[model samples]
Target: MIPLGGAAGRVAGLVLAAGAGRRYGGPKAPVFLGPALRVLRDGGCDPIIAVLGAGARRTRAVVDLAGVQVVDNPGWAEGMASSLRLGLSTAARLPEVSAVCVHLVDMPGVSALAVARLLAQAHASCLTRACYDGEPGHPVVLGRDHWAEIIETTRGDQGARAYLRRHAGHVTAVECGDVAGGYDIDER
Candidate 1:
């Protein structure tokens, strides 16, 4: 199903949808990039958890399509770091989730296949990041080992970028040959 090696192990799809979207003045996750797409609709990357804040209700409603799990971030307004912490904390508890692909909901072009590939690559290589477009993007395939560190840094604006930089040695870049892989549309 997930394309990972050997046993299924545990892997998670962690969607970050908690931003305030100050510029767009609304929730970005709900933007209908393409609800009809087959890859996102049928890929079956489940336990699809979405971290929601700011416009939590709206985001929940939009991404909740077909029953996706939504986790509330109490300190989400603090920044992406808090949201990341909330997500990783929840992901750490899933028994089948040995790895996590941190996703940005508004990265509309990201497909479930890319996510599966990253998840598989993480297990095969035992690494912590799945880069795209020559740069690190969403769906960062974090191995089971990095859960502790990700959960601990839950304050201010501290984010995964710093850690990604520190652990650059274990990163793997999977180019989808698409700019959408590197694009970040934050209500703009």
Candidate 2:
């Protein structure tokens, strides 16, 4: 259980694990869900939300859904945007959540330490993204102020790429390559 209230404010974690893993042969959820949840929990994120779609039943059967809130994205087949929208919307409803840290299940290289770094560098009114060797990547932190806009602009699998690009000036990039890798295991 995460302690409530800190200088950094209360931040919820949103894990996007609803993908069908069409290229990975089977559901990536069974492989990544547990570790992902552990990373978020250990990183001090409260009320972590894991969005499930493809193989939801199989994932539930294999993964331990203990402390996290599992939200099923029925429209997940549409793409990542639906999951993102579900996560952001759910986070917004929590009065204690001032920001959200979004993580992808496929990126197992991302560590709890890197998530801690992102949370530590997060600003109340600015966007923060983990950087690998100076290149922006996930676990992206988005302040409540940007949630609505992000939900509005996010589409398909692009996620917040366009919105972040347009508001690059307001983003805070934290270097975490030494501690974690932001590689996506989409194939094989």
Worst 10 residues of 1 by lDDT: 32-41
12-41, model 2: which lDDT tens digit per residue?
889999999999997799999999988888
TM value for model 1? 0.82
After superposing candidate 1 on the true structure, give the runs of residues whose Cα lies further than 4 Å from its correct spot. Answer: 1-8, 32-44, 62-65, 178-180
Candidate 2 segments whose C-alpha is farther than 4 A from its true place: 1-7
Which candidate's lDDT is highest? 2
For each candidate, give its TM-score against the true structure.
0.82, 0.94
Q: Could you give candidate 1's per-residue lDDT for residues 1-188 as a string of tens digits? A: 43544315656667777777777777676663233122333434456667777777765455434555678887887888888888878877787777766776667667666665665565523555445656666657677787787677546665687777777787767766452354566556
Model-by-model lDDT, in order?
0.64, 0.87
- What's the CA error at residue 148 for candidate 1, in Å? 0.4
